[model samples]
Target: MKLTLQILTLTSILLPLSYPIEFNYPSVFNFGDSNSDTGELIAGMGDHLDPPYGMIYFKTPSGRFCDGRLLVDLLMDAMDLPFLNAYLDSLGLPNFRKGCNFAAAASKILPATASDLSPFSFGIQVSQFLRFKVRALDLLAKGRKYEKYLPLQDYFEKGLYMFDIGQNDLAGAFYSKTLDQVLASIPKILEEFETGLKRLYDQGARNFWVHNTGPLGCLAQNVAKFGTDPLKLDELGCVSAHNQAARFFNLQLHALCKKLQSSFAGSNVTYVDIFSIKSNLIANYSRYGFEQPITACCGVGGPPLNYDSRIACGQTKVLDGSSVTATACNDSTEYVNWDGIHYTEAANQYVSSQILTGKYSDPPFADKMPFLLPIKF
Candidate 1:
């Protein structure tokens, strides 16, 4: 059967029931870039990302870059919480009960080095969360009791704080600088990340899930832009040099997590190995029912993979004096990539399943003090 968003949502809801009693976090607070953004970019900036972008599931542009739910959405659904609302949504903060997403499309980890595509940085997202906490506490102090909302005392300490950043940092660096230059910047980038984590730790956040950078070499965008030579490409058609950069970053991040675990007493700081999980998926695409592993499901104006960096998905423009509109594949499920940069809904489902399994997580999710049980989707 085709894996649609509805099916994925249903799977998320039902999967947790069979697991043993586990750490049921009161809420989830996420910070990252487009990968975890629900609608913050569209809500805050009013970017015109029109039709076909969200046609697969939402049937309308929901500010998500992909065709359906992101890993964060599925993660929340697995915990039986409503998908988080973008903190900047015009509808207002109706539900802090489940938590709010501070993620924005194109956001970077460092404000100083952010590209034009990413105006908001990780620091900005965390600042917004801090402001939200103040308001939530103020409202509670005013004796305004809202249903499903937790008291300020339990809310600050018990929430799950998630970070899925650093992709844009590397992307920006690699595109503008050399591989050696990007490698040199990894330590400073990780230091900025550690600063953000420390800020949250000081603010009473005890449960932390930090997702490492994925295998950027396998992305259709990187392959199209950097994998021109056969020797530079891997067996899976991914850029070998780019994947090496990703590995270096992940290794540094894992070591940082170890340091964080020691620094934050009684806190659960876990490093999620998204790079390994995604790399394995691309290497073994057939096992995951994916026919096209490296090519984008939606793109235009190119050879080999048909991806055009100038033309975005769901867009039409004059290329070489001829109008070209980016088009999607007949079956999105058959392709792992959505639009050269993002993953398809089906691929995200598989990745999310692995994340919840406690397999890729450092210190293992189930082994944590709160005892998170594995989800069986």
Candidate 2:
């Protein structure tokens, strides 16, 4: 009875009120890489369709990289909106009235080649959004029959334009470029980002929520691959050079947000400091009820960081004449890393909780989410 009452109380308090003070973004148009991808990669490329990927929430692989809901999913729920369907997915003739997701696994700010994991670069995503908007308007122009299936013309302007990319850009650069070379590429990357944002603004996108890249060095993949040299690792066992690159990239991104805010009037551009939130979570994992901060829950190998690039989660291979399957941890809630590259659902939930507090956002939401204060997982 006590547990039931607690659950009820939490749910009631967490429910978003229809108050006049909150931001009412009717829909959301999201862009980025795997961190926010709903199912564009799997929907377009037919990959990662396996068990243990979406076991916790959807009871099956739902095209998301995480085991369950992502930060984007939680944010949409908070705003009383349905999850965005991948723009490339057309299996059920999915509804696009709320919005659409253009993010894909391995996507980046710059363009991607055929050899890349995802061909939907930031520019390509913007192009898709443009095509989507045109097609949606055409559908509505036909008559009222299409109103339930697609967004209205004005929904494009009223909706929130969210970005959660750039991680892959910096992370991928480290594979071939030196630390200084990687840092030098930051300007060009942000230049491409700025170009994309401007293109969206030209198309009537006003409200923007941009998330800066997080600590890349702390990811199990990077740590396992780059932390071979003790001298290269930081006090937290993360790769120092990778983290340094991320910090520099974030600094540039924040400045770009500030610039965009000034360049475009009547625009509400909010720069979210996701790097600080993630770094703090990893640094204080125990306080947040997490056990393995830098280790991947669904991966091969074991110990400090259970990750092996050779085998991904839910994949099986014969090694030394024996089958080896990289499986998920018994309890995913205890770990922060999901599959070396992404965050677990629990960690994503915690990040979402912190984001709701309005503390991590620049020009903060004026403490609009006070109801989140008493809630705890």
Candidate number of the best TM-score: 2
Colliding pairs, model 2: none
The candidate that achieves the highest lDDT relative to the unseen native structure: 2
Q: All models: lDDT?
A: 0.81, 0.87
Task: Summarize candidate 1's per-residue lDDT along 75-171 as a digit string, tens digits.
Answer: 7766767888888885744576778889998888877442367677888898999898887777777675653563355767898998999988887
- Per candidate, the number of residue pairs that clash is 0, 0
Per-residue C-alpha lDDT of model 2 across residues 266-339, encoded as one tens digit per residue = 89899999999999999998877788899999988888788889888889988667899989999888888999
Tell me the deviation in Å of residue 163 in model 1.
Answer: 0.7
How much does candidate 2 score in TM-score? 0.95
Q: What is the TM-score of each candidate against the true structure?
A: 0.92, 0.95
* Model 2 lowest lDDT segment of ten: 1-10
